[model samples]
Target: MTGYTCTSCGEHHEELPFAYSAPAPAFWQDAPTDVLEPERCVISGEHYFLRGRLVLPVRDADQDFEWGVWVSVSKDNFFRAEELWDDPKRTDEPPYFGWLATELPGYEPGTLNLKTNLHTRPPGERPLIEVEPTGHPLAVEQRDGITLIRVQAVAELLRHP
Candidate 1:
């Protein structure tokens, strides 16, 4: 009944908009040299620094989940994830950083859609679905480098933010 306008149907409803928020770097190829606080990797046995932000959902229904950016290092690898950045502003076990020892060339930041797939894993449920970035940053670092585009913490995203 107030301050709510639909983008497609032109319907008026009452709800807070800013539900989903993403890192949204100006361009995919641009990034800051230093984004994260210095930290040691538990997996790679190396010292690395990183920074990142979460890509929030565009809809209020999607805001059910907490959101933010994440960049951390462990013995295994240095990581920057957009989807998993939950708002400890509410829960525990923030999986902010975790991975096996490995090396990452780097990545470009952008928004992504979360989905579900029933083809793999524990069955009955399709976990996080990460569609490739149409506005990717400088191609997925050399073909061999492998760009691990993934989506996780979906249910959570639909539960908190």
Candidate 2:
């Protein structure tokens, strides 16, 4: 397997799984409500913007934490999400998807374990994830006014724990 030394973490990795593919957190269901109002960017009263730190699974031993993430939801998808936000019986809906809006300073795209089908927008257009219509225990949280998602907690949520 090919490997590269991470300049940010100084660790040798056989593969970079920076791209994360997991189920959207349930709390994302009510993005219109759950999303902090101040940080929210609403368009035409039907679309809203969701942006925050998306904690990656990559750990930095020196820093004792995982890498940083910043993702944003697309406008059209956000509108669709709003329509289904309060539907109690909308259980069969497909997962909400978002683009990979930004890139880490030193990482290359297509190397991370992110879902391939998802479209990545320009630097200003952040990546998107399907927001579950419910709350996932480990999905969303507030820290210093930033919405953060911990990779560890995400793993646990994926395992249906």
Candidate 3:
């Protein structure tokens, strides 16, 4: 199977399914309302930032895992995403583009500056992000159409001025 070569880790991957600010999974029903809400992708100035958990499907391993991601979205792509999020009927759009601001783990919150291209998958498949991480990662939890993610961890990333 031909796969995409990851720019971050220099590994060829056959499948890397990821999700953005998707609806929460069923297990997250007991979470606080705020925690159960889908994390918003915010645009500041010309860049967009999102703090949330992404579900990455490992085809070879036959399992899926979650990672806390912080992304800086491109201006044009951010606008496209806004449009898609606002208009549920517009599902034929292209994937949005952004940069992975930090590696999956190891560095302190504000120190890591790992820059890598991150693109959203086409609508309907949980918006896959294609990349690998070093160190420990988070887990995916969703319920009632909201993603139970690291709200505080992601908030710190956006709080930077």
CA shift of 76, model 2, Å: 3.3
lDDT of 1 at 30: 28
The digit string of per-residue lDDT tens for model 2 on 1-161 reads 24445544566656433334222221235444344342244444543454433432223322222333323456766665446545643344454455333333323332122321222333433333322222322222111211112333333333333
Candidate 1 lDDT by residue in tens digits, 94-142: 2323211111212334322111111111222211222233334312221
Instruction: Score candidate 3 by TM-score against the native.
Output: 0.40
lDDT of 3 by residue, 53-125 (tens): 4554443344444555555556676566656754555455554454555444323543233333444444443
Which runs of model 3 end up more than 4 angstroms from their true locations? 1-38, 41-44, 51-53, 58-62, 89-91, 106-126, 132-161
lDDT of model number 1 = 0.26
Highest TM-score among the candidates is held by which one? 3
Stretches off by above 4 angstroms in model 1 are 21-67, 70-72, 76-161
**lDDT of candidates 1 onward, in order:** 0.26, 0.36, 0.42
Error of 2 at 127 (Å): 12
Per-model TM-score versus the true fold: 0.21, 0.29, 0.40
Q: Indicate the residue-level lDDT of 21 in model 1.
A: 28
